[model samples]
Target: MSTPLAAALEKALQGRVRRSVPVTDLHDDIIPCPAADLFSNDYLSLCTDTRLRQAFIDNISKEPLVFGTGGSRLLNGNASAHLEFEDRMKTFFGAPAALLFNSGYDANVAFWHSIPQTGDAVILDELIHASTRDGLMASRARTALYPFSHNSAASLRDTILHVLRAHPAIAAGKATAFIALEGLYSMDGDFAPLPEVVRLVEELLPAGCGHIVVDEAHSTAIYGAQGRGLVAALGLEDRIDTVLHTFGKARALTGAVLLCSPTVRKYIINYGRPFIYSTSISHSMMCALSTSFDYIESSAGEELISSLHHISRTFESKLIAALQYTPSHLLALPARSTPADFPSNVVSPIFPILTSYPIPLARFLRNLGYRTRPLPYPVVPRGQERVRIVMHARNTEEELDELIAHLLAWSLELQEEEKKEKEKEVLLATEEVATSKSEPAKDKALFTISLPGTALRIAVSVRSFV
Candidate 1:
């Protein structure tokens, strides 16, 4: 009964079926089983803050009531409120222009799919988000895309050199080179080497032709004064050409903004199809966004950011210490997992703890009331499967301690299971050896070979010569 399309999908998915299951209970808004909220992206725990919610309600009450934009922005969707928010974000982020999108994915797709021209080139990190890749694939300049090793300066330099050799116009300043990066990677939980990347692009590409674009989706409202992001934290806001900030994570709302030059803003307004064809953000969401920004800049927001950092550092230190005796094949951290590798003042809320047994580990933690999800192959690379864990301002020391204790218990249990399995295998091999030796040489053709590091035997059979 399988159609061609259905068969194709089955082959592609290979038994890995994804589904939409709500984490919350059917009757309640809280997470099911009353598990701790460590699996979501709400880093600052702003989603449940009563003050922010009250402020949003107040702002919504002042606005003219409208549930949805009637049409696309080019038609009847463009509101004065939208323009006002864009202006506010422009001034807040210290950018010349700002344009809103429905989500970060929309912004990335619109920007990457339409911006780079045929003569221009885009050199990106290998670990760039899938949205950016989809945009590049649909772009006219897709042929010119080049990916360098993740966070490797030398690889970036080589990629630039290759692009220059292949496209001489880029070297001559007749064409532009766009360097794409994420301020804080979602999966790896590591910061990009922005300073090093900026210097490399400036050194290699033509003086004014290299454009560095940073997507601050994960870092927005979590770093810098008033949550300006990592580019601002490093005092490199003036150097970066474009920055994308999404509000869904720490802001506890939807939509994103692209901060760029006035010229680039005008270009996207004209050429970006996602922006042109899609309805604008809702009126109430705009009010919520404003309230969120007001909170981020307030004194309470600063305290929340500090609390997030303190909790993150505590978790990282404890987890690293726990993994010290663990086998790399069982559990480990990425090479750049140490604090010294991150920005001096920033400790990311996201952690991608590597393990081949992600599903089992996540299930164990979830059963213990610490909710986490596994990222298996295809979401990440095969050997790099992990369980993504996030820290929030509200998570306390006692919670972390309990989670770690459960994790260690699981690890110990796994080790014990492995020991018993090996013993079983050794006993079976010994029985085989005994049986082989008892048989006559003419009737039996068997030999046992010992392998190093374990008391196990491999049986080989040979024909007896008459």
Candidate 2:
């Protein structure tokens, strides 16, 4: 108890914080489990695609290497294959330069901690990914979080003005400000107001120094005609200062890339600790990522994005309708507010199933043979727990239908139970009112009553009859 680590460990255990279960084997369909896998960030089926397997094999044949990188890039680990992969990524993402990282977390930490100077300011969205926040905290620069109302350019502009006004000491040529946000949010599955944010940054830059950075971790290899990501899709590749793309999601592989100007690349390579101290990515992983990029360049990647969009749209339509209808001959329940109006130009393949209690939803789905993950508090703020359903191109239409059907069935059952509980409450209230009227002269006290195992409670006043 005296030790901080021991206290924290005890709190975690007592809180029953769930641990992530590692999968030893793979399967095609995740059904009949206690929860469905609506929480994965894997937007493309590439994670399990057969073509990627062949691509990996082909790359390994061309140049044989093992699992580990012997040293850092500045040391013996700097392989020619890594250089070639970076070059290919630079071309793919249309950046002047690209640098590889062990993962998105490492990339963000390296960039945020080392890139900005001590006098610099980082104005980031309030809801940016946790990794970016951790990176910003580790940085030497002064940072401020600004609420942009979940993709409102007007809000961002106001936030920028507020930050400048509040930090007058830094405003007068003492510091520079950088704006950071994600192209697509992981939780809401919505995009940032890039055009407006970019415009505001440019307007501010004329008066003072300002820069913009975007984390394209969820947008890469899934948007635009060539799958170049949201920034490229919007034709704002030249407008943003830096873009971070991870290979784990859409690329269905490992590693990450930080796309920036040549100057920024040089600065990071010279100063970034994660890149300098740690061993570089292995030649094999580099080659695998290279081959994955090649596959993206081919027509198959385009087709896959298109297929993913179609599946996403289909799933959305079906689920919305199912939410509205009754299942199993029961009355339907009232729906909560939708997360946000669907963006006119959606890019990512993630969608949110907003629920009051995500754990119960996950449990219900799991009982029906769907493998879903529940996003509880801490990852998201308290009271915003949700089931994040991600669609992949490889998922069959039939599987989607079955998943929807089970959800509809569960909803209907819950509705029936809720209706019964409400009726019981009404009846109890009526009895209380009747008793009070008959015994108006007697003093009465109100007592609370609960309908067992249902989300309904009632208060009743009792009195003696005259």
Candidate 3:
């Protein structure tokens, strides 16, 4: 017997959008349509670089290992190549040791679950990546969310103090407290105040009571003189207890590394479930990552970093100019009248256009041949739906101009529709209120009377005329 489709399936399929390029039935000589690329995470465009590709190929050819890891790293999967990559990363990021994971998600989960003891308390930023929060939930430690006031070090310190006071046992060294935060927040593209955080930890945290862990997933290959990430850029390698770096973004590869002290590395290696139970990353993958590390050490990597900086600056200027020309009417309805709806002062490259509803914004962009992602509820709380436009060094000036044009036109149209809807709602509400006010008052004398039975009953009546 075959499974039947649900009734909801038909509705879901009604307006489903397809990818820009068709994946199937491609001809050898066909030239694809020219669509501006705006929906990729390849910020530095390293994935498509001819030189990087050749380096990857060359490394694979020179390496002895190929194909899959037969078992986990603790078992039969650990290879010499894997060890080489780990050593290279450890030196590159200025950490005592480094351990590799298949992906950022796995690495984060593994670190969170393994590092904190049963009696530890994990304090994380409110807006941390979902993976980090998920990892914390899976860990044995008790968790608390601190308010992240858009790079306000004062807020972080205050929150930590509050938590410490609330949980005196943790402060007294009876329990551990771990502070977890990302060096660069994924959604906002803003960075945490690492220096201030370090100072706070040194000044406030009692010995054996707390530690700080920094997630460098978005910062890797995007900061530092050698692109070693923000931690290395700020000379905070020894200051942070652990640093998480990934190759999926700026590194343009698959896999991530956790940088920590030798003792911590040994502990996680022995206890981390993702590393213990799952098959290790393949040797071929290790070779690719090793090649990437080699490229970073070479002169070509310096040139790439310089190019990325120039590109990022150009993109920022173009975006700001475009925003200035956008009509004032295009602005979305002011945030709802609530404390949480208060405007934020944080500024970064990730541009979020708040909307009354995200579906309209998504549909409008789709119709204009631009792909904008919708960040709705669950990801963001209700009433904060927005269209997130991520910029990259790979995007060209012409593409940026085209995107701006489409956004301006779409905004104007949306504003018109919103204005009309508001007017209609106001008129309907006014009419209803007026109709209720005009209704005649009831006469009490007609329904009221005196009755005699076992006892006398009296009713006081008032006269009314309408």
Global lDDT of each candidate? 0.83, 0.73, 0.68
Residue-wise C-alpha lDDT for candidate 1, range 14-98, written one tens digit per residue: 5454421113324433453476777688889998888888988888898885478787789899988799999998999899999
Q: Model 1 — TM-score against the truth?
A: 0.89
**Top-TM-score candidate index:** 1
Give RMSD to native, each candidate: 5.3, 5.3, 11.8
TM-score of 2: 0.83
Q: Write the per-residue lDDT of candidate 3 for residues 322-341, one digit (tens) a residue.
A: 66655443433222111122
Q: After superposition, how far is residue 142 of candidate 1 from its true place, in Å?
A: 0.3
Clashing pairs in 3: none
lDDT tens per residue, model 2, 1-466: 2799999877676555443122223473443234434446667677667887887887798786757779999888888888877887887777999999999988998898887786677788777888887777888873554545666667788877876787664567566778888988877777787877887887754444677899999988888756788888778888888999988888877889999889889998988888899988877787788778888778888788888888877877777677664542222222322224334446456767765556666667756666676665655665565676788876667878877777666666676766887786667667767765755543554656654332335555443212
Count clashing residue pairs per candidate: 0, 14, 0
> Please, what is the TM-score per model?
0.89, 0.83, 0.78
